[model samples]
Target: MEVRLTREQVLALAPDAASSKAGAGLATDGKWGLLGADAEALWGECQGSGSKPYQTQVDLAGLVSRCSCPSRKFPCKHGLALLLLYAAGNPRCVPGTRPAWVDEWMQGRRDRAARKEAAAEAAANAPPPDPQVQAAAAAKREASRWSKMEAGAGELQRWIADQFRQGLANLGNGFEQDAQRMSARMVDAQAPGLAALLDHAVSGGGRDLPSLARLGERLGLLQLLTQAVPRVESFSAARQADLRAALGWPVDRETVLREGEALQDAWFVQGQQLIEHPGNLTERRVWLHGVASGRAALLQDYSHGGRGWDQQWRTGYSHSGTVHFHAGTVPLRAVASEVQGGTASAVPADDTFDVAAQACADNPWLPQVPMRLSAVTVAHDGQRCWLQHGEGTLALQLAPMPGWSLMAFAGGHPLCLMGEWDGQVLHPLSAWNAQGEQWERSSA
Candidate 1:
């Protein structure tokens, strides 16, 4: 089916204001040659400063942009210009047979999809394995893991009780070192999640009683996990999964796909942000707000060495897909089971921050929650920003670069915006004007 994108949607893909302006400048027929659009793709050649005109194309089905230009910014000016021209229904973008370059890209995507389907079919039709043998092997592994965890928990319990007896004032600076050593023991026992909590506690170095109290709470949670691990089989499936995750067991993607609940909806790609973690790993969290279900979902992707993740979904885009949710009490996190089609469309957003906060109460363990506010003006005290809507205000806690970008887009005017709210602060990710003008900054 043929797909058309709006001007605001095209601008939302721009990395910055300069790129938006430059892309708009190149949208005219005078700057482009050999533009064409088929049911599934858009292609064009943009005359640029270089000797060779840049070839640009958009895979409408996947909302993926490609350009034969050196610019690293996603959906570079040439690609956006091609899209804008197509969105304007320019005569040059009339339906035609795709060129070699376009057909090659399309074929690659189709081949990958076909291979995935074949693999899934093969697995489904394969004979069942010997259940008895599998169960015996799994039981043996579980027993060994339990033994190590038991020992580690015993050690941690003794250390925690000893700290209380010694008293915080008497422990001196060495107390922090003791915590780190215990944290290392937990890591050795394969409880990296507990290790992380201990690391976070000691990182503050008892600067305040409130901080110490927070540490106590984390320790309490760890102790609870230790208790739960021994009785894991007795707990419900969802609770067991939650306990395992809290104790550092990794989520099994295959298991989730095989047994997890699935929901299909028009998911609005609200916002995304990157988080730095220990061990040279970086995580990108993307939020999707469901249009029909009125539920939120989180897509977490990780990369090593801080290289950064590619733009999978742009802000202000809508993706119709099937999502598989992990086993949990509040299933806000999910994996995209199938991405059918992605388009730029306006989706309804909750206007009040309170409503968003209430929704997060279902999954209180989440560090951040997705929120959307309508007609909110950006207020600056020359230091930071506050999203003011009527009588309420939510502070924006963003890094220098994104803070400036948000300010430039807001310009003291009210906007329909989407962002991440971390209880205390809001990080604005994208904004749209009344006239459908859009500005998005997905990084940081």
Candidate 2:
């Protein structure tokens, strides 16, 4: 069967606004030399300013795109335009056999995937390592790393104290450089989590009052982490894991799958958010809600360069799976295995502020708490957007485009909204109308 995709979905795959606009402009038939698609892939050649046209192809199975253009961006304008044409059901994208170039690329991908699968199978079938020997080596490594992190934490504590003594007003001139230097030091000290905290503290330049306050808050958290690192052994197993994670130590995925907490349920994909960081790194957070257990889980994935995600989880769909959660005082991040697509189920939006407050009380370091509110209507007060539910209102951290999209979808009526609450602001990711139709903020 031919691959089918909506125009919104095609646009969502664009790497940036410029790419989206350029792809849209190139979607017409006259802009291309040849365009065709089969069940497995689409191929096209777009005439650019160069002497020859650029060959672009897309694998329908994975939505992977490749173009013979020099652009580092994945799904370059030509590839995106090709997909857009196909999505629009343009007559030019008629069914055709795969060309030699497209067939070669697809075969290479299949070969690589097969090799990876074989390696995984071989490893799984291999003999188990000696438990005693493995344990001794692991313990030794952990102890050495702990020593370095503890010393680093002490140094950071002193640095924070020096800042307070010098007064926030004196943090001028080269303060940002100093912070960056300190962050690098934390990385050398094998405490990348601390390094990340330091980076966040100074990210705003410390010029505005709000930025200064955020810096102070981050510093306070760093201080708390410093104090806890030395006494981590005294905490419970789950608390120790939480503390270690805060200190930049994380359990491996295999370990989590083998020993961490696991819950099997029908999980509804509530929404997702993609955050782009420096160095072309992208972080994706997919939120899921359990239908029977009424628990929320977060699936985090990362991609660098132009590589895409390993899997696509559509909003408003259900998947039956076993989610293995990382060990923590309040386990939220998880890995889903044995997942199979299922019919979408209605997510009861009955959560309240008390639920979020309780989560915060349980885990002070928690950055975002998932919330689903029913009968919530979008409201704007000239400058900012708000989500009004019953007698209470919460500020929304939404861009103008998405805010307008949400307003248009809601049409002044109440809807069920799913979002991440970061103590103060609610960043909406999806909303469902009375008819159960979903409007995803990511598509905006």
Candidate 3:
């Protein structure tokens, strides 16, 4: 098969850092036997401590893997190493017939996919439910959920007040446990969004001033949300939708496609980032800029148990797509229902700090806003890296290596930098030089 994936892309599929390191180490020819590939898949036998060599195969189309290793992690280290070797164009992985085991596995995967599609088609063609009955049931369920959320919000409000009255410094050794318990309570109350906020407050910072300030800010936002719960009906539809979303009520994909705001534009893929969460879950965020509308959009995808994302978006490319935006005061998150082929495009880097500030002003709860700074140079002052745009400078929240890479790429010249700004720090994702050469943040 024509392996189009870069080494970085292949490593991005690793479940964790340890897997990525181990896979890279095993990519050398010394670790494997009978490595082979064809148009459909790649298969190899990795010699482990066991009597028999472990069999690993990867489906190129879906980027899914099957391995004989006794590991719960999907696409275990052996599978990752096999793909890594293929991606590196190692001589050992030559064109060959598919093994019987690999053939059976690939066929089973295709069969299951076909069955799922057929089932979905059947459901879509099935007789419609009674509209009034469906509507009533939905309304009842919503009302019950809202009632539970309101109670949760009230309890949260009280908890916040108690924290302030007792003073944050006095929370003592049980603060972490208390926060965990409160977060669990929010989950039981069917307010996962609130629970997530508490979790962030617990994990986001230490007992420092800045961290405490952020914690206070989050608590204040929660206070406002709790106060708004009772008066939600008085707000506009969009505002109510925002409040509901903040309370952890998600709009289904079908509902978003049918009722949410739709915009058709050639979206420039600015950058993407992957965040690893608890429970072996990874969240990928892809930021896009509309060429015609001059608007920003975010596409989020989640992978559980290392199955991997459904799509891969490359930087420095533009795709013609229709994005259906989720309901919010500031519509940024979207679902791309239709995306055509991608073509190389220049980075649309015209935004400044003011844009991010205004976005935050409009929606205080927004965690991050995309920014593209024009004519910016990376500056390192012995301690941290900063982006120097004209006379203004923004602190960069980047690791040392990537920061050095950005500085080196600039070579003492100005470049267009695209990144996400979270009020205090700018996280650079991709950069383009004056000649339009692109530099993406390393997945490693």
Candidate 4:
């Protein structure tokens, strides 16, 4: 039997808000007719103003949508409506053979996918370019970038010195604009990390001495980068990548794939969060814990202009997969290469608070370390809540509702809790009691 998707999953595939709304409006039986679904395909016809009904088909395996409607959207409203009806188990969508149109569309998609895979395989097996030529070209590119970055850094240092000479008190009137202008120069210097830092600094209210001190710290960091860029290769691969990332440089996907540590394990999804950034971009962060390896990895996905993500990682699920680690960081962050189907299950809390502290000890810049606290109880005093795990008690950074929810879920008993421990605070993600049932606590 084919797996059914939830209405939320179906709507998440829509390209934009307007498409989702339109698809929702067309989900009723009156708007759709002749609905049929097989193991491989789901097809339906929707009545529109035109004489002939619009044909819609969904490739179940790929979850690709096709519609004969005049809309330019990838999955037109008709396709979304068809999937909605099918997902809802509407009787109108009875089991049947796929029509010729649906079969033909599916065939085309399969062919294209096959071709893409073949091309990728061929490219991977191809021989490398001449070593001498490659070396010379790389050297030239590096020299050019070095010159640009050096000039940008020099200009930034001068600007910082000027700010210091003029004093922080006198720079309030146009400080924001000044920072933005300097940031733009950094961007022109191809130092995106520095630009982002400046933007971040200015975005925070630059109205006080503390803010000015923060700006000074940023300048100090940039000064370090100016010294580091020339001899980047001297650092470890992972550290080099981190530095480049900090400098707003991109890592080549192919390079990482070819030269990275591979770990195969049953990874449990701890939790996932979606954040919206400026310029209408969405950032998705998925945290995973390797059951056997006891390793934590983070997978990041980004979508632009209201488009949805390519893949979905549900919280509280576990799956077998191979994750490739980027060189040079501890408490590793990785990119998933292959993931088999996942099953909904309770995530085991095996590691302890000391594990988090050790990770932070290794990498002080690490913002969050995964920790599992066993024999832990929520301690609330009507004003604040804290988690008493093992020998240590730590305060939780949660609002009233989530804190109360945790208390209710624990119910005065010691439960195993899983969450990230930033050096100072514990951000609970999920928890499970002795019976292995998940303790439903909303993320704060």
Which digits, one per residue and each the tens of the lDDT, describe model 1 over residues 183-289? Answer: 99999998786677667646656647776676666566556656666687898877776666666776777787777788889988877655666786767778888
Cα misplacement distance, residue 35 of candidate 2 (Å): 4.2
- Candidate 4 wrongly placed segments (more than 4 Å): 1-58, 64-89, 94-128, 157-171, 206-227, 230-238, 305-311, 351-444
Model 3 residue 228 CA deviation in Å: 1.7
TM-score between candidate 4 and the true structure: 0.68
lDDT of 4 by residue, 340-431 (tens): 76666676646567777877776544546777788888899888889886667887877788788888878888788877776666877777
Give the per-residue Cα lDDT of candidate 2 at 239: 86
Global lDDT of each model?
A: 0.74, 0.83, 0.82, 0.74
When sorted by TM-score, best at the front, the candidate numbers are: 3, 2, 4, 1
Q: How many clashes does each candidate structure show, in the order listed? A: 0, 0, 0, 2
Quote each prediction's TM-score: 0.67, 0.81, 0.82, 0.68
lDDT of model 1 at position 30: 89
Error of 2 at 219 (Å): 1.7
Per-residue CA lDDT of model 3 for 151-170, tens digit only, reads 99899989989988887766
Where is model 2 more than 4 Å wrong at Cα?
1-42, 45-104, 114-118, 121-128, 206-209
Worst 10 residues of 3 by lDDT: 305-314
- Candidate 3 error regions (>4 Å): 1-32, 35-97
